[model samples]
Structure formats: structure tokens, C-alpha cells
Target: MLYDLNIAWSPSTSAAELERTLRFSAALGYNVVALNHTITPPVPPQVANPLPKFPPSPAGPASSSSTTPDQTPNKQPKLPTVLHRATLVLNDPSAYHRLPQLGSSYDVVAVRPTTEREFQGACLNLNLTDASLISLDLAQRFPFHFRPKPCMAAVNRGLRFEVCYAQGLSSSVPGDAANDARARAAFIGNVVELVRATRGRGIVISSGARGALALRAPADVVNLLALWGLGSEKGMEGLGVLPRGVVVNEGIKRSGFRGVVDIVGTAEREKGEREDKAVGKGKAAAGEAAKEKQEKGVDNNDKNGNGENKRKIGEEEDGGGGGPEGDDNKPMSKRQAKKMKAAIRKAQNAEAKTT
Candidate 1:
């Protein structure tokens, strides 16, 4: 599914406008969209998500056969899957401690670094912060350049870089053509530098659009990125694969144990238990059959008179039998039988001499 991970949201935003933007985004083929609430420094003591939950769009199959004449011809457009996101603006490195709290509250947690030091920290040291995306306002000029070392380091650590197309599309002040042109130039130059830094590996293209007019189709976004030095394949991945990975990783951080292990589903656990029980039953049945066979063998030996003969042989071998032919009946080694015969002969000679 296509993803637009960043769409600007604020407390002052009206519900109607937000709904219209979302509908337009869905119409442009974005299957999933995140409503991003940007938070600045000095975060509140009690961090809570303020984004309102929108009801599912009423654009499914018609349930009623009877249509009223009063029904409007233009039906409500189907909305995409909406997710809540929070973007923490990092101006100082000390404010990074509250990331875990914000991450727990939002479905996706991102960071916008303003300075060089903060940017490096967000790229390399923010692994434990549960933040998945590093969003930078590329429309402004910075003293530092986007180097491959930090950008690729962030990508290797499972963090994606967000390029918001809306920043280049319009100026902050309305009716200012010069500012718009300058912002566009800066955006294009920064995008080229960023693409070269990471080699277009972990880039995620998003609208970051506050209104519906700034939103573009997925194909158009890809083509736009291609113009700015990112390959078509990589741009497509930025929209679909990379953003999806960020979403999934953020979800795992919330639900998984320290973001490492996940609990198995009930169905899988039950299946394993059933297999173990079946194995145990099979082993028990086999053991019982073996025991019964042994008992049957002993009974057969006794019934056939072989058991009595074996018992007699054992008694004779132990010198416990009173029969005269006990020595002959006993099973013995050849040397042992010869020694017995010689002893008997010596005893007979001694008895005859004494008599």
C-alpha cells in the first residue's frame, strides 16, 4: 500500500478542512496517511495525543434498495486508513529524553532537527528514542551540508529521512513570489545533496501538506524526486516500501518487548500445544504396548514349561539343587567343569585311604 507518513496537523486546524484534505489524498491513491502534529520544545508534563479520531467514510456499497430523491448526487469520498503521528522539533539535544513518552502516545514518532549537532544526534543516537523518521525542513539554507556518514548511519539504524514536497511547493507568506522561488531553489539543491549523501537509499517522500491542493499523486511525486536526483525505483520505494517499514517498525516498538520480541498469536500457541499433547499420547501408548508385550512374553515362557527348566538350571548353578545330576544339568565353562571333576577325584582318593 502507498503511504504518506507526514500530513501537517495542528490544534487550530478545522475538522472540515482536514477531512477535505484526507479525502483528496485518498482520491490521489494514497492508501494510508498519517496526521502529524508538530511539537516544539518544553513539552507538556502530561503528554497526550490531541488528534481527533475521524469516523469511517460512508462510501461503501448502498445498503438500501429504495433511494430518496433528496439524496445528493455527489457521495462522500472514501477515506484512506488514517494514523496519528507526532513530530518533535529538536532544537536542543537535551529535549530528547521525552521521545519515549511521545512515542508511546502516537502511532508514529518522528523528529525534526534544526541544527547540525541535533541532526547528528537524531541520526545516530536516537535508536532508543522509538523515533523512526528524521524529518528536516530542506527549504532553508544551513551552514552544514548533508554528509553521507550521518545520513547513511541513520538509514542503517532503521531510520528514514522525510522530504516534504509541500515546503517547495509554496511560500510561508502569501503573495510573495520571490520567497516562493527562493524556497523552491533551496529545496531542490538540498534534495540533490541529500540524495547524493545517502545515495537515495532511505528517502521517504511525503506531502507534509496542510491542505488538499499541495497533495500530489504517487506517480507525480516519484517523477518529481527523479528530477531532484533520486531514481524512479527508489522514489517509488520511498512512497510504498520505506514508509511502510517505518510504520511497521513504529508499531513493533509500541507492542513488542523492548522492540525486540513479539508475542505469538493465540492460534499458533494453541496449535503448538496440541502437537505436543499428540506426541506425548503417542509415546505413552508405545510404552504401554512394550510393557504389555514383555509381560506376555514372561507368561508364555511359564505356560510352555520353559520357565521351570530355567529356574532349575539357575538353582543348580548356585549349588542349591539336591539332585545327583545337578552338576551335569548346570551350565558351566569348560575349565570350571574340569576343576570340579578333579576335586571330586581327590576327595574320593582321600576317603578310600582314610577308610
Candidate 2:
């Protein structure tokens, strides 16, 4: 499905206006669209720049009856899926600290760098950020240039560079023709530079359209991207695939554990698992200790039996209880007999002294 990843949505924009924009996007065959709320650094309190909340049903009427089989009365008109996303314009380095807080609430988070310093910070610090659209529309006012190192770094980190086509498309407003022409030129130049720097690897084409008139069909966007130096395959990927990747990665960042593991089971279930594991371990330990005690008792019994056997053998040999054979059996070795006689004499002498 085609995805238009950026559409300016703000607190100031009425629900009717947003509905009109989304209807047009759906009509143009975009399957998914991001409602972009742009926040400027040094955020003003008056502006309620909260993330867009998706409504249960689309703003307009449901699909009406049609003669075509696909559009029958029973069939429902499919409105483009809405996603809540935010774009932060970085004017100060310290302002970046607020992104994590804002990112948690939004489906997708993007950064627009207004200065060289901001651009560097975006590339370095926003490695985990969703996207950073080259603010080429602001090139007429700012002297920021797209550098390669940081751009490639961001690409390696799964951060994409957005090329917004809304401002670059032809404008017939008589007073704004010159400004629009300059914007188109700068946008084309900046986009070309980005494609070359990233080797056409991590670029996404988006409408960045505020209204229906600015939105284009997915085919038109793909063709426009092709004209801007990306291969046809890359163009298609920008519209259909890369934008989905942004949504997926941003979703992981929002819901997953430090973007590493997804949390699916409930807390109660997790606690139960831990308790079960502890109980099992305790049982195993108790069983092991009991087995060891049983084995130790058996060993002690064996040792006591061995001592009794030795005592019986000693009594038979020395206390006239008889040897293993017969009393008549004596040591054949003279030395053994002599040693036995000496031991007997020593015992007799001790008895006499005691008496």
C-alpha cells in the first residue's frame, strides 16, 4: 500500500479541514498517511501541539451504493489509515532534550534542522529518530547545506531522509510564483544531493501536503521521485516500503523495551511466571538437599559397619577370641613370633607392677 508519511496537522487545523485533507489522500490511493504536527523549538504555551488522535470513523460519510461490484452497498469505502506523527524544528541544540518526551506520544517523530549546527546535531543525536526531512523549503531563508557523513550515519541507524514534494510542485498563485519557483529549485537541488550522499538507500518521498490540492497520487509521487534522480525501484520503495519502515521502527521505539524487545504479555502474567519459577527452584533445591542428607546417612552407616568389622577382627586376634583360622595356627616367621613374645612380656611386666 502507498503511504504519504507527512501531512501537516495542527491544533489550529479544524476537524473538518483535516477530514477534507484525508479524504483527498484516500481518493488519491494513499493507504496510510501521517498527521504531522510541527513544533518549533522554544515551544509556545499558547500552541497545543499534542499528537493527532485517530478517530474511530473517518470524518466524511461512508461509502454510498455503487453500480460497480467492488463499490456495492454492502462494501465499505476504505479511508486511508491515519497515524499520529510530529515534526520538530530544531533551532537550538538544547531544545533536542524535549524530543524523547514528545516521541513517546507520537506514532512517528521527525526533526527538521534549520541551521548547520542543528543539522549536525540531528544526524549525530537523532540516530534513533524516525526521519529528518531536509528542510530545503527553508533553504531560501537559511544557508544550511546537506553534508554526507552525518546523512550516511543516520541512514546506517535506520533513520530516513524525507523529500517533501508539496512545496516543490507548481503553484499558480500569482503573488507567490517567484517564491514557489525558488522553493522548487532548492528542493530539487537538496533532494539530489541527499540521494547522492546516501547512495539512494534511505530516502522517503512524502507529500508534506497541508491540503487536498497539494496531495498527489502514489504513482505520481513515484514518477516524481524517479525524475529527481532515484531509480524507479527506489522511488516505489520510498512511497510504499520506506515509510512503512519508519512507522514500524517508530512504533517499536514507542512501545518496545528500549527498542530492543516487544512487550506483549501482561504485567500480572509476567509476575506469575516469575513466581512459578521461584517456586520451582525452591522445590528443586529442597529435593537436592534431602537427597544429599539421605546419601550422607547411608555413608555414615557404612563407616560404622566398617569400624565394627575391624574391632571384631582385633578381638579375635588378641583377646583369645580365636583368629580367623585356629589358635594352634602361629606365625611361621621367627621375627613375628619374637615380636609377639616381646609384646606379651611387656604386658606381663605392666600387670606385675600394678599388682
Q: State the lDDT of candidate 2 residue by residue for 1-355, as single tens digits.
A: 7888788776677876777788778778887787777777785534344544443334421111111122213243455667777677878877667777666566677888777887777777765744434433432444756678988987886777887888677542546878778777876787777788788988888887777888887777778878878888999898888888877777666668877678777545588898999999999999999999999999999999999888765644554332334355542334445656898999999999999
**In model 1, which range of ten residues has the least summed lDDT?**
60-69
| Model 2 misplacement above 4 A | 44-52, 56-77, 127-142, 170-174, 264-355
- The C-alpha lDDT values of all candidates are 0.84, 0.71
Q: Write the per-residue lDDT of candidate 1 for residues 81-195, one digit (tens) a residue.
A: 7788989999987678888889867888899999999998888898743688999999899789999998999898888999999999998788899999999999999999999
Q: Clashes in each model (backbone N, CA, C under 3 Å)?
A: 0, 0
Clashing pairs in 1: none
Best by TM-score: 1
The C-alpha local distance difference test score for the whole of candidate 1 amounts to 0.84
